[model samples]
Target: MAEPGDTSVLATAKAKSQKSHELASCVIKEPLFSYAHLQVLNGNPLQEPIELDALQVRSYCTAALQQFLGIAGTAISIDILKVDGSDCWLRVPRDSLGAFSAAITAWRGTNENGVHTTFRVKGCSDWLGSLVGQVGQDTLWSK
Candidate 1:
């Protein structure tokens, strides 16, 4: 109903809002290293050699691994699976692990080094539909 003295613009605005594209925008950056250490400060008991400290190589500590990924503008969300066969191992490099931080409020990106690398975890590594991973210190990757 239109009142004679009131020219309401909201009615038309409501109609336009109803037909949306259903698309939510997100920031996308390219990958950084061919192989990098992904931290297990957030551990996954589902994978073998999971205790990275038990390994004999010079590996980045979990905290450092998260930080390196942060500097590269990527979040490491791992999905560990206890599969029976050869599909169970993710042979990440010794430097693949990185550090996590509280100052890292949002996943940020940059490409200032003349490199168009993508900062991403494989889509399978989406933990809890969010960037940060915390499994009460004793977690398992379900992928």
Candidate 2:
């Protein structure tokens, strides 16, 4: 039997207290916005690569929404996070992801200067970090 003043008992209690203090966690069941990784594609792969600016991205998304859902779709908020080459990142209300995805997928692409352009959703997640890398690469197995 261990005595009330036993050093081992006190040490064990201290260790448990320290362990609890060392660990912290926060769980968000529902995020306010979801992120999407979009790739802009043209009809011809051999054509010059498309470099999209913020304005162009907004215009494309807005046009898609407008065409799909009319005035209501146009009101859906879209935030463009980054645009590199033909890839773009966007954030939209968590509840509106389905509508947004449908809009982009179904809309016929626009033709400008004989170049046809459209958006494709590569991946989407409530957490942005999950969509950061190459869309299909398994990060765990990659060097």
Candidate 3:
């Protein structure tokens, strides 16, 4: 025997629950990855030299490329400079050119076709992207 104007307590609660869920969804950030931030950078290698642990950095680079751009196995040679931690250098196939470089991205190094392109990647802004400590030169052994 509810009054005509009376609101159903259960209905009001369900509506509030749905609203709370929507608010929660907004708070959950999806991994920040967008093709809009990627591009093939064209230029000379920067004045800064590539450093040690190039292999490791390249690994991160590869994963990021695959995760963000859907490219894999495109990398060719990765050299660890060993002079400085952050100065690692990489060389991949020229075909990979379009795959690695992003205008919003910074790609550096040579390609397999002997066409070299060096650019720096701005820090990756994704849940999986991370900067591991550089591989120091003291530990590098060139082939």
Candidate 4:
């Protein structure tokens, strides 16, 4: 029989096995998505304002993605979180954030006046609440 203070051969082997597993195992990172806050603007400053609802915003975004990324762009998913006036809040895959933003900038939106418009990305974050709590552009001028 082994002494009280002595560990058994099985115990030593089990400890070594656990140590090996701890060393060999790698920490996996959780996938994240970036939430983008976009503002639709009239490209032609001279043209009247073009107000858009949730559907119209999605439609315009779809068109932009189609124009910039072709058929593949359509595969990218977009969730419209909210729409207030000309401002829009949306979410896109974090990995695709760059491509999505680039596509929006590259494409031009046409207003009811037959004039082109632009999509301005005001802010982007992985957390939805962060975007919601952010200050508006007006805050830039505040003391």
Q: Which candidate is the best by lDDT?
A: 2
lDDT (Cα atoms) of all candidates against the true structure: 0.31, 0.90, 0.41, 0.81
Query: Candidate 4's error at 35, in angstroms?
Result: 0.5
- The TM-score measured for candidate 2 stands at 0.81
Candidate 4's TM-score reads: 0.69
**1-143 per-residue lDDT for model 1 (tens digits):** 76666646667767778976757887645333222212322222343432332231122222333454544423443223222221121223223323222212222322334422112222122222232233222335543
TM-score ranking, best first: 2, 4, 3, 1
Please tell me which predicted candidate would have the highest TM-score against the true structure: 2
Identify the runs in model 2 with alpha carbons over 4 angstroms from their true place: 1-24, 135-143
Per-residue lDDT for 38-102 in model 4, tens only? 88887677866667699988988899899999999988999998898888988899888888888
- Residue 34, candidate 4: Cα error in Å is 1.5
Q: How close to the true structure is residue 76 of candidate 4, measured as C-alpha lDDT?
A: 90
lDDT of 1 at 6: 62
Candidates ranked by lDDT, best first? 2, 4, 3, 1
Question: In candidate 2, what residue range of length 10 has the lowest lDDT sum?
Answer: 133-142
